[model samples]
Target chain A: MQDLLYFVQQLINGLTIGSTYALIAIGYTMVYGIIGMINFAHGEIYMIGAYTALIAITGLTALGIVWLPLILVVALLCAMIVSSSMGWAVERVAYRPVRGKHRLIPLISAIGMSIFLQNYVHLAQGSRNIGFPALIEGGFRFGAEDSFQTSITYMQITIFATTLVCMTILSLFISRSRIGRACRAVSQDLGMANLLGIDTNRIISATFVIGAALAAVAGLLLGMYYGSIDPLFGFIAGLKAFTAAVLGGIGSIPGAMLGGLILGVAESMTSGYLSGEYKDVVSFGLLILILLFKPTGLLGKPEVEKI
Target chain B: MSTPVKKLVTAIATSIAVMGAGHATAEIKIGIAGPMTGPVAQYGDMQFSGARMAIERINADGGVMGEELVGVEYDDVCDPKQAVTIANTMVNDGVRFVVGHLCSSSTQPASDIYEDEGILMVTPASTSPEITERGYELVFRTIGLDSMQGPVAANYLISQDPESVAVIHDKQQYGEGIATAVRDTLEEGGVEVAMFEGITAGAKDFSSLVTKLRQADVDYVYYGGYHPELGLILRQARQAELDTIFMGPEGVGNKDINTIAGEAAEGLLVTLPPSFDEKEENQELVQAFEEKGEDPSGPFVLTSYTAVQLIADGIEAAESTDPFEVAEALREGTFQTPIGTVEYDSKGDMESFEFVVYEWHSDGSKTPVN
Candidate 1:
């Protein structure tokens, strides 16, 4: 009985972390969906969002603003605005000039932008890990001591709910809104979209902005959940989110969500059952296997290229 | 035209003469190498600051043999190849002494260049036992060896009478060496070794490993690696609801671990040197760090400060700026430091100071187990 409860707890923990991965993965998948280009700087934007929230909350708390919910909302908004600006700027300066060129060229440029943003953040924040205040305290107990307690925390629930709401709103906007259709048109055929009187540049820029805002939400949630933020925090999270996107289907919105959640849950189960050290090996190993077996991913649609 | 040529020649001669004079009275140069950029740049920065402080303080006190000690800083990036290149550059620049090469892999390779160049190198915090055991006369470290720290950590775990113990390492030379030592020592002491494994470093997820441990019914885990992997392990373990105690060597004593682990770090035990803040004699050093707006609780900060002091003491004792003489003096000399009395063996390793256990608190301070 105790063993069963432990398994359930581990599952919940995995799902919570998976939700964060899902959020970041959505950004990667969305950008890739439209441009057929990876936004390597997406992770750095996520890191910046966390730092932005940190600085904003620190400033607010110093002024005696102590309400937790109010601080979170304001911090999230600040993160979104800062990250969106960064995303748009990155597209204009780094991506736009070389768009429609060789595919590898833009990929290399993204890599360069990734390194540049990492160093830029390091210089701005100093090469140290800054601790963020916990958004919520105390664990949620599901049962009595003799029986078993679920051990879910308020922060975990909040992270899961926020990710679900963001993902739902994103899905709605893409499917029901005019801008969404424009984005889809661009992704389908950029030249055709231009022929149909769609502003390709505007749609691309908006895609970047929206994707970056979602990444910021992930960053903020990660900062609150882990209670720490550093300049290089994005590198690993970005890689994992990219992996999640590919695992779920690189250009599929729902696929990225499924991939992120699966990756997170798999990691949690591995850590719970195995040694914590092998969890990463298991995750990447799973990625390699999936790519080999199911190239289109679990939920991704197959794309046929014109020769 | 002849007169103009004469004027130009005279100006050139005068400039050459002044340059020669400056070279004759130039400062004594020492090289400091570490990861100036990378995840561990914090350690390098602290080292540079501490070395600079020592240089300033020593210069204010008339310097060694009336020559100002100047430091030449290089970024090794904690890579062996980069370390070798930096060592070659330092040697070419005529630096007689070196204070760095933080990681063991970097230090081991760089020490060869220092040896060939007859330049003495003193490491403040590189604790791998093999660093000095390679029979390099010019290489030395002021910290205890992993051979000592590993057993100390294992003894601490043994005292707890854990039901079962699992040991894991990051597969690096230093990480694996320390982990093996701890595992061997525990096994020799009759403790049940439930699992012994090695994992790749820089891995982001550790769920599978944690799950295996849970299945193995292990009550304690001893990890021998740096903070990155250890932090992830602690966090993931907590997330998995595993309540086992985790312990590691001094390599896991970094404040960055607390940052990465956050609340998950609470109750985790790490074997490190005694706390400098708790040492009554280190009160002044603590004040100095505070004045500089840096926390003294960081393991490397005090170690860096002590490294600077060691270099200055060597210069003073040798009464010369020559690397050979100063290194000889350092090997034989004893000095009081913030961590207490310090002395080096002929292998250029610290002969005194035993490792103690400390528990990392959620507030980022380590509490001594005593």
Candidate 2:
């Protein structure tokens, strides 16, 4: 019974964080799906989202706004809006100018842009970890009080439900929305989509905006969860999400989701049952194993390249 | 990599050297290097200010060796490679004394350059034993070594008589060193170390660790790392209702930790260089800068100030501005600084150092556990 509770609790813990990773991974996978290039700056957008919440909550509370719910709503919206705009600007400045260049050129540009945005935030907001109040607190306990307690917090529930809702809405929109079909067309063949009057520029810009918006939600959620953030949070989170994208087959939405959950569970299990020191080693090991065996990820479609 | 850019940097260096040479005869120059531009620049910024305050006070007291003390500053960004490059540049620019290169990674590498170049390096804040144990005659640290504090931490945990203790680290050099120190000491003391774990710094979640702690029913957790990771652990442990006692090294004692951990910050026991900031004798010096609208209550301020004081006093004791002479004086003499009378042994480590456990309170303050 004790072992079962521990297993269940760890499973809960994994899914809670996995949901946030999925939210961020979707941004990476969807962007890569439409554009053959990785949106390396996606992580910065997530970072900016957290910064937005930090600034918003602090500023609002200082202005005599006493209500927590109102403050949270305003902060969340501010993060989403600010991150989406920043994403749009990055695509316009970093990616658009070298759109038709060699694939490596744009990829290099993305890396550069990532560094620039990171330092820009570092310079602007100061490099020290900024800690904000948790959005919600406390948890519900499972199992007998005398036995080992398996706990789940309200914040965890909110995060899991929020990710589920976001994922559902996103999948429906992609399959049904007009802009979604255009995005699909552009991803299939950019030149052909442009010739068919699909406004490839608008579609790409929209992709960044959508991706950045989701990233903002993840960032805000993360900030609320950790109650601490620094400029470099995006660096690791971005790498992990990129790993998730690759493990999910790089450009597949469902693959990204599956990959995020698997990565999260693997990390949690490694740290829980095996060793915390080798958690990262195991995470990358999973990526390598997936790449070796499936090559296309759990839900990713195998790609064929022609010279 | 361009010729013009290279030329521009050379011109800048040459002009600064010429300017330095102009004032070289009248004033003694001390170069302070740290990460003034990186993520941990806050430490460097405080250390720089502390060094500045000490220099100002020394100059006001009619200078060391009858020569006005001068401070030269450099930014190494807390990176080891950059620190080496900066060390070389400082040597080339005629800097004979240094008070910085904040991070242990940066200091250990740069100490090589300082040693080889005959520059006396006094690190105010780097606590890794490698800084002192390297047997470099010129290398000295004002802060307590992990070797000293780690045993202190283990002894404190052993006294509590918990069911079992868990040892965790962030897997960095300092963290690993300190964790090993505590772990080894605990084992030596015949305490049950239920878990030996390492975590990645800057990771957002610690749920698995928390769950494991709960499952293990570990009564105490001795973490050897900075506050950020510990903050999350404390929070998640609270969320898991583990009620485990979270104790950490000095790296976990910070205002940011309280903010990060929220209410869970309370009851955290951390080992730190005894409460120097609260000492009545130090309050005047702390207040001197506080009056000037600068907060010098940071961990590195007094230590960095002591670094400057030691260098200045060494110059006075040696009766020369020579690096070798000053280093010899530092080894042989004890100087009274703001943190109290401090003396360096033959190895450039303090003859006796004290580490006290402090309990974190709800008001974002830490009081010594006593």
Candidate 3:
């Protein structure tokens, strides 16, 4: 019973973190889907989103806003707007100019954009981390009072619910919305979509916007959950989300989501049962195993050679 | 038409230029290296401000032995590779003395180059004993070792007579080393260590770790890491309603922890260098820092200032700009600084350095507990 409770506790912890990873992974998978190029700066966009949310929250507090829901709503909207603009601008400046060149060129450009954004934030905010106030606290605990217990915080619930809502909306948009249908056409074949009057460029831009907005929602959630924010906070999270994107099959939205949850659970289980020190090693090891066994990822389709 | 006259003019010009160049050579370069822009750059700000003030004051006091001390600052970002690069930069830039390379992991490698290249270094913040245990002659520090600090923390916990304790670290050189020291001491003191674990630095979540702590049922937790991770751990642990008392080393003593942990920061036990600014003799010095709108209370600031002062005094005592002479002079001489009277042993560590335990409040105030 104790072991089961512990396992459940780890699962809850993993899912909370994994849900945020899924949100960030969508950005990577979407960009890869439309342009067939990895947007390395996607992580920076997420970080910018978090910073914007924090700034908005601080601003709201200074303006004597005491309502919790209103504060969170305004902050989320601000983060999404700022991050969407940043994503669009990054695509215009970094990815668009170098597109259709050597595949590595845009990849390198994305990397350059990532570095530029990191340094830009570092200078603006100073290198030190600032604390994110925990607006929502407390949680539900299970099990006997004297024995080991499983617990979940309100913050974790917020993260999980927000990700679910975002993913659901994203799924519906992709399946039923006009712009979403155009996005699918563009991702399927950019040249063919252009020939078919799909406006591939606008579709690509919209994909970036959608991905950035989701990442911003994650930024706000994770920032509050973590209780701190720094300029370099996005770098490691970005790498992990990229790994999730690869694990889920690049360009597959559902794949990214599943991959993120699997990776997070694996990490938490390793930390809980084996050792906390081996959690990262386990996660990365899982990535390598998936790449070796199923090179296209668990859900990714095999690439077809162009005639 | 006038070859002899032109030759005379050239000689006169050359002699004046030589005289000017000779006069410019009277300045001694003191290299100040640390994390100018990185996660731990807050500590670097303290290091820089302390060393800068020392240099400014020494210069204002008619310079050291009629030679002006000039500080050359470098940013290592608290990274070992970057510290090595900064060390080489110092070597090539003609820097004979250095005051930092803040993190123990960064300091250890940078000190090797300083030893090999015949440069004198005195770190004010690094506390890992391995740095001084290597029998390096030119390496010195104005801070206590983790060996001293760990025992101080352990003895305090033992006094409280906790039923069980959990020791945690960030798995870095400084963090793990101190955790090991604390664990060993607690064991010797007949305390049951419920768990000893390592966590990844820069990781945001600690819910699993907090759950483990609860499962262990420890009454106290001694975390050996910086403020950021510990802050999150504290906040999360509080949210989980784990009633364990927490303690940490000087690495987690930053005021920013208050912001990160919120009310959870209250009652945190931190072992830091003695509050030198509170001493009677340091009032004027503290006032000087206040005049410049700098806080003199940080553990590293006064120690870094003392590092520079020791370097200047060492040069005067040796009466030579050679690092070897200054190092020998430092080893042999005893000088009074803001922290205390300093005397180096054979390993270049202080003969006696005190680590004081303080109870930290959420309002960014700390009161000495032991």
Task: Indicate the docking level reached by candidate 1.
Answer: incorrect
- DockQ metric, candidate 1: 0.21
Greater lDDT among 2 and 3 belongs to 3
Better of 1 and 3 by DockQ: 3
* Per-residue alpha-carbon lDDT of candidate 2 for residues B1-370, written as tens digits (9 for 90 to 100): 9999999999999999999977775888899999787656767877999999999999999988778888999999777899999999999989888998677888999999999999999998878897888789889888888888899999998887776899989887778889999999999888999999888877878889888888887778999887778888888787667787888987777777877788889999988777666788888887888877776767788889989999988988999888899999988887888777888888898887788888988567877775
- Predicted model with the maximum lDDT: 3
Candidate 3 C-alpha lDDT tens digits along B1-370: 4999999999999999989986976899999999999878889989999999999999999888998999999999988999999999999999999999799999999999999999999999999999999999899999999999999999999999998899999999999999999999999999999899999988888888887888788989999989989999999899889878899999999888988899999999999998899999999999999999999999899999999999999999999999999999999999989988999999999999999999999998999995
Error of 2 at A66 (Å): 4.5
Per-prediction fnat: 0.29, 0.71, 0.81
Assess each model's interface with DockQ, reporting 2 decimals per model: 0.21, 0.54, 0.73
Clashing pairs in 3: none
Give, for candidate 3 chain B, the lowest lDDT window spanning 10 residues.
B207-216
Instruction: Count clashing residue pairs in model 1.
Output: 20
**Residue A14 deviation, candidate 3, in Å?**
0.6
The sequence of per-residue lDDT tens digits that candidate 1 reaches over residues A42-72 is 9998989889988888988999999988999
Model 2 CAPRI quality? medium
lDDT by candidate, in order shown = 0.83, 0.86, 0.93
- List residue ranges in candidate 1 displaced over 4 A: A139-150, A305-307, B1-21, B35-42, B76-85, B116-118, B165-176, B193-223, B226-248, B252-268, B275-346, B359-368
- Give the residue spans of candidate 2 off by over 4 A: A66-69, A305-307, B1-25, B37-42, B277-284, B295-297
TM-score of chain A of each: 0.98, 0.97, 0.99
